[model samples]
Target chain A: MKILAAVSRSTVARVLNCIQVLVPKPHVAVVSLDEEAALASKAMGVEFIGGPLPEKIYAIDEFKEYDVGIAALDNDSINISVVKALRSIGIPLVISLLNNSANRDLLVKEGADYVIDIDSYVSQNIAASLSMDKWVYVKPLSIVNLTLAVVRLARRSILGVKLGELKSALRSKSIHLMAIDRLGKVISDDSVELNAGDIILLTGIESEVYEASMDVEKLFRRHEETLARSFAESLRASTRPYG
Target chain B: MVFALKSRGKVSLIIYLATEKGVRNVKHIYKSIEDSISVVDTYIVYYGLGAFKQLMDIPAFHSEPPYCRGKAILSGVNLVTSPVIVVINGDTSCFSIDSISNAVAKVLSGETLLHLSKPQTNTDFTNVYRSFLQDILGELGITQSMLYPSYSIIVGLRKFFTTTPYSMWSIEQLAAINLREEALVVENNSCIDSTIDYVKGFEKTFVKDLARKAVEIALQRNTISRNRAEEYLKRIEAA
Candidate 1:
């Protein structure tokens, strides 16, 4: 669909570059109140408009310009204003950036088509990384998937057994062990014994995954907490004023 | 609507000083203004030391010395001219500096600052709560979430208890205690111990009443008519 994105210059450039890598060259229009942005977007093979906002808004009307108008501007007020102006013209699919949670109900009440909270999205990913077990930080998408997490095992731990033994132990739960990653590299063969920091990627439903991961997480939590506490203590001691 | 404070017939310059965290986005905003408003003059003042350094390095930007604090710098600018001085958070991931600047410009020009409501982040909650309090105190609207004393109170408590030997009280705990203490001080006048407590108690009541007044003002200003606002008030009362 033809998309008209109103954003700051750098963001527009970054978004355009990201879109270029993901989708085929699409009919995209970058509308900004800055000339440099228009030039930059034009360089990236997107349509650019550099004029007064109302004039630019009117200019888009001549062409079967855009189906979705994304007002990803940083300011909540401006995003809402742009959305309101677009909605006034009967534009479909008005997406906006809603930063503050208090404004969500108001934005919805005002008829915003879609509101994306980028901060919440990033924070959720960060929280997921901290909460999950045996997950890998997928560099490209920054998505923490189950496959990349490290599953900790103690020397005398019940799961200290080899991969085959652990698989057998987890068999009652019908959990499928997909792959094991150690120090960032995935091990191909399943015969290797599970050691400390050996993360086993498992595929299962919510209950199965929770049961399996919770066991590992509980075992590791104490050590992790101890290490964290000690590290914090050391940091504090180092920063203390020396008389 | 464009209130030109200067009689020099020159376009008034509105300098927006953003934190270093927001410099990259603010530069785009500067460029957008240059493109859109052919007559008006504009400059950007970056607040954070790091942001100031970055702006100094950029050949395009005419850098001024870093402003130590965002509000202080904004107030300083207000002293010189009445051009809209926009201040935004450096760490904001959602919007660019230019968009905020544009919005501020609109507000200064007497246009409505229309904002869409979304879910509040921890930062948003802190900011909104603080602004809500400050607005009640009849202060100029403060937008940045970090500037609120409540957030600092929480951070101070967290650091003091968790990282330092101050105590086991987290910032959240301190905030709750402070809030409860203020509430109790307002409710029971007998517990007033110090001048600070009395001031805080008065401020709390004033802010609460001001918030109620603000809601009334918002209702009047809202697109919904007086009848609708009254209906809303009735529904709220019924609930």
Candidate 2:
């Protein structure tokens, strides 16, 4: 889809970089709150136009020259206004960026076909990060309350700890181990041991989910401390130069 | 021992193991589920993480080699029966309960599970720093606040600097694991609730501009007739 994103200069640039990865490279038109951003976006292979809400509406005309009118601006009001204006023009599919919680209903009432909230996106990132067994993925569930995440286990300093022990520790926090993703399948077997780099598909409450995430970190820390102690002891016994 | 259970004939039993966080509320959800469906055999697991930890004390539950892919599946054979597995997530918060309930129900119904939760909001440091910037600009009695960045800029920058790398890493990891079988059930009540706050601001400025831009872009692309574009422009101007 041809996406016209109206954002600040810096955000426009960042969006330009991120969009290529999130979606197919479309005819991206960058509209900024500043004029320089417009020029920069055009130079960066995005259709650039400058101006704030309402006034910036004039720039949308430029995109019509390219046979696409679908646009999503960063500002909720601007996107809604743009969508409303397009609706009157009988345009189809006007999506707005709804940044605040207060405006969601109003935007829907005002005729926003789709509203993308950045805050919600961020929360999803945080959830994703919590789900990570390896390095954290900051935005795990952007779709809100309807996501299943599969995360790989990180290489922990703690080795040989049974899955049963870990589960017990996590159980104290009310976290449940839904299924373990090992090799390439989901294992619900209770007898399975958790190995380093094993992927776990965890399902639970948000806080519990986060708590379960912390348990993995705690296990790693405990393992690392144990390993360090043993390594020191071995070094002392061997009289080897401790690196 | 509080146990929240729900089941449909011929389907898996969906249960939410209650914890102190929302053990009280779990009764309500449990009742609601029971009212909706016929629950089969049920078991009461002790509430709290301590109980779970103790349960794990059993050697059979301990981590071991060869890995147990659920007793029901075996090498070119199947053994254990598919008794409704009451999967419990240790989320005690109300939000967690709701999310877990939704996920479990979906799984039991043979639906794909998707993780659902509220979207994270940006902490408005702009408003905080806005006052500081406004104070600096106040010396000249020029309260225009142009020196201050917009909330979008602040949010965009924060996301770019802090969240981008993490998101990229996650996407990469998800790709590597490639486990696409199980369905993820998610709840978006918080998302829907939060959007109400920004509606007015959106209606006043952002929506207005967005409407105008839609027309402009349509006109620019020649996707719509000039007359239609002009009409759109007029409608927004009128609004």
Candidate 3:
């Protein structure tokens, strides 16, 4: 497919890199004011349009034949203007790189088919990685306004408790223990005992699931705290004060 | 940067963590953000009984038994004394200091509210939520194509959040208020509400960077305190 890529400054490299991976032997047309970008585009064997974007794009007659257009400029206002112009000119698919989060919805409203904020996307992925243990899988049950999350019950306090006993608490948090995995075995039965290392699948809304997970952690901590306190008390009672 | 902000003396950030799962996620999130940017006060506003006695010294609020989204937010808001408050979901990944700094900049620059968007997933639930939100906004005379706020990261003036009514519909209400104020919308969406998402996120370059950065920043801030950030970094390294 013929592609029109509009870039400004350092973003040219990132945009070009992405395009290279997306299409083998890509016939992309690059537009930018950066001389280095023009040189880079020439090196990549893509058509180069060296000038200011959005306005420069409208001047190119060959742009009409392009199936997709990408506005990956660093400036939000320029990106928005260029994407708006691209959309107005009937580019079937237009994507814009959003540098600022605040401009995301504004660009979307401007008719860009897909708006990506690279920073947010990357950071979100990073954030998700940091907290992987809380929820294994989260599928939104659209019809029920609930999300299904596969959670590992890592807290020892909640171990050995029957699912039936935790039912009321889970229910109060809007969570349902749909299934449990105990040492490679999946148990759908409610009466099975919960173990410290068992994987428990839960379903609830985002808020509900969050609360449920917190409750589970609390149980584990409470168990540990009590054990620690009792052990400390026994040691104190068995020994005399040296002071 | 949380500590940096505190040291600067010109500004301060109060981070409100909304949780129902107790301290497991909160502890990790707190240290990650602290490591990534040691410039803020992190508060744990929870619905659970108590597992966070260590944070007892830190100002906190307890939501009434049986969690409610609205109450948690409102309770956190009531406790916030900073000019700006960042209300983050406990389950979502903690944002880097730069992200929070950017949000504060927008807040200071006349924007009334800033809502961070999550990456859009083509899930049945997202479609449903989008359609519902679009229809509701349409009826309210708001443009359907306008930005919709994700509940993951919300930053605004202290009074704005504290004064708003707390309920399950608070997010919607916050969006509506944003519409009236012409709020800033940033896209920084990451919610691991499921195993699938968590796995996908773990496999990404940024997620790995997050763990690494957490360690680097933690070590830079305080080598003596082997906090959760260190623990998480070790786990990531081992994995």
Residue range with the least summed lDDT across 10 consecutive positions in model 2 chain A: A137-146
Off by over 4 Å in 2: A1-3, A18-28, A58-74, A127-146, A149-243, B1-239
Task: Give residue A236's error in model 1 in angstroms.
Answer: 39
How do these models rank on TM-score, best leading? 1, 3, 2
Candidates in order have lDDT scores of: 0.43, 0.42, 0.57
**DockQ: which is higher, 1 or 2?**
1
Q: What stretches of model 1 exceed 4 Å from their correct place?
A: A21-24, A51-65, A75-179, A188-191, A200-243, B1-239
Of candidate 3 chain A, the 10-residue stretch with the lowest lDDT total is A136-145
TM-score to true structure, per model = 0.36, 0.31, 0.35
lDDT, candidate 2, residue A78? 47
- The candidate that wins on lDDT is 3
Model 3 CA lDDT for position B95: 50
- Going through the candidates in order, the fraction of native interface contacts each one reproduces equals 0.00, 0.00, 0.00
List chain B TM-scores, each candidate: 0.34, 0.28, 0.59
